[model samples]
Target: MKRFLSGFLIGTAATVAAAASVVLTVKKQVIDPIDEQQVAHDEKRKRAMRKSAAR
Candidate 1:
């Protein structure tokens, strides 16, 4: 019983750690680039609007 409990706890911890790392990696690789692109696009759109307004 003790051995089984220990194994279960260890497995749970490892799964949690792996899930956290995957989330972090996805945020770094995917979310960050998408966010950066959106920011740049918004800035460009704002600039275009201002230019048209000026004209």
Candidate 2:
């Protein structure tokens, strides 16, 4: 019973740590760049539309 409890606690800690790491990595690697790129893309599209409207 003691061994089982210890193993369960270890597994839970490992899973939580791994999840936090993945979330942090994804925020930096995937989410941040996508948000930046989307904002830039939207601004570019807006400028193009404005230019066409002016003409």
Clashing pairs in 2: none
Query: How displaced is residue 52 in candidate 1, in Å?
Result: 1.1
Worst window of 10 by summed lDDT in candidate 1: 1-10
TM-scores of the candidates in the order shown: 0.92, 0.74
Expressed as tens digits, the lDDT of each residue in 1-55 for candidate 1 is 9999999999999999999999999999999999999999999999999999999
Cα lDDT of model 2 by residue, 1-55, tens digit: 9999999999999999999999999999999999999999999999999999999
* True-vs-predicted CA distance for residue 39, candidate 2, Å: 1.0
Give the runs in model 1 whose Cα sits over 4 Å from its true position: none
Clashes of each: 0, 0
Residue-level lDDT for 18 in candidate 2: 100
